[model samples]
Target: MDSAPIVVHPPTGSGGRRVTVRGEILGLAHSDADVVEFLRRAGLPDAEGLLDDSAWVKWRGGRAHHYEAA
Candidate 1:
């Protein structure tokens, strides 16, 4: 598995994705803003910008910015 600092897990049945930072579960995010907020709270700089940065975040089971399950 990729060892990125942030990982946005696959969306759940309710379309919420689990956001984790350094293996720490931040929360379940339903939107990009929620993920950004989680990162902000975790003290990560430029949280929103990191969304598209593969080196910073690893998006699993979905494309970037996609909250709904495939």
Candidate 2:
């Protein structure tokens, strides 16, 4: 099976959802450029999504897009 490592960092004072793939930072996990491009690169098209808006602690891995609030 093919799998990709997706890491998410909680947003800062004026930042958006930050994510990493294979240990490389990918900007915002909730943005079209970052997270969307990531899913396409990982070949998980249907896994695109946004994270919950309540807390800053979220999932660490998935074909799905995950993020944390600041």
Candidate 3:
């Protein structure tokens, strides 16, 4: 099976980097809105609804960044 690309957006003042995971990480952003922006930029379908148990991201950077439900 194929997986999603991993995109990492640098942190602004949130302390943690924003990440969008389709299969891996499609892109990064500061917030879900930004993440959607990334999706718009990529010209890809919004997979925000696909975020669930299938996506397991363990950040070694301590606490997780702010993310929104798809």
The C-alpha RMSD of each candidate to the native structure, in angstroms, is 1.3, 7.6, 6.6
Worst 10 residues of 1 by lDDT: 61-70
**For candidate 2, lDDT tens digit of each residue in 1-70?**
1133655655544545666655666566565456667656766564454333213224444323433344
Evaluated with TM-score, which candidate comes out highest? 1
TM-score of each: 0.90, 0.45, 0.40
Misplaced by over 4 Å in model 1 are: none
lDDT of 1 by residue, 1-70 (tens): 5679899999988788999988889999989999999999999768999998899999999777888854
Against the reference, the lDDT scores of all candidates come to 0.89, 0.50, 0.46
Clashing pairs in 3: 5-25, 6-25, 48-70
* Residue 24 lDDT, candidate 2, scale 0-100: 66
Error of 3 at 67 (Å): 6.7
Query: Between 1 and 2, whose lDDT is larger?
Result: 1
Give the residue spans of candidate 2 off by over 4 A.
1-4, 30-34, 49-69
Worst 10 residues of 2 by lDDT: 49-58
Query: Where does candidate 3 have its weakest 10-residue lDDT segment?
Result: 51-60
TM-score (C-alpha, index-matched) for candidate 2: 0.45
How many residue pairs clash in each candidate at the backbone level?
0, 0, 3
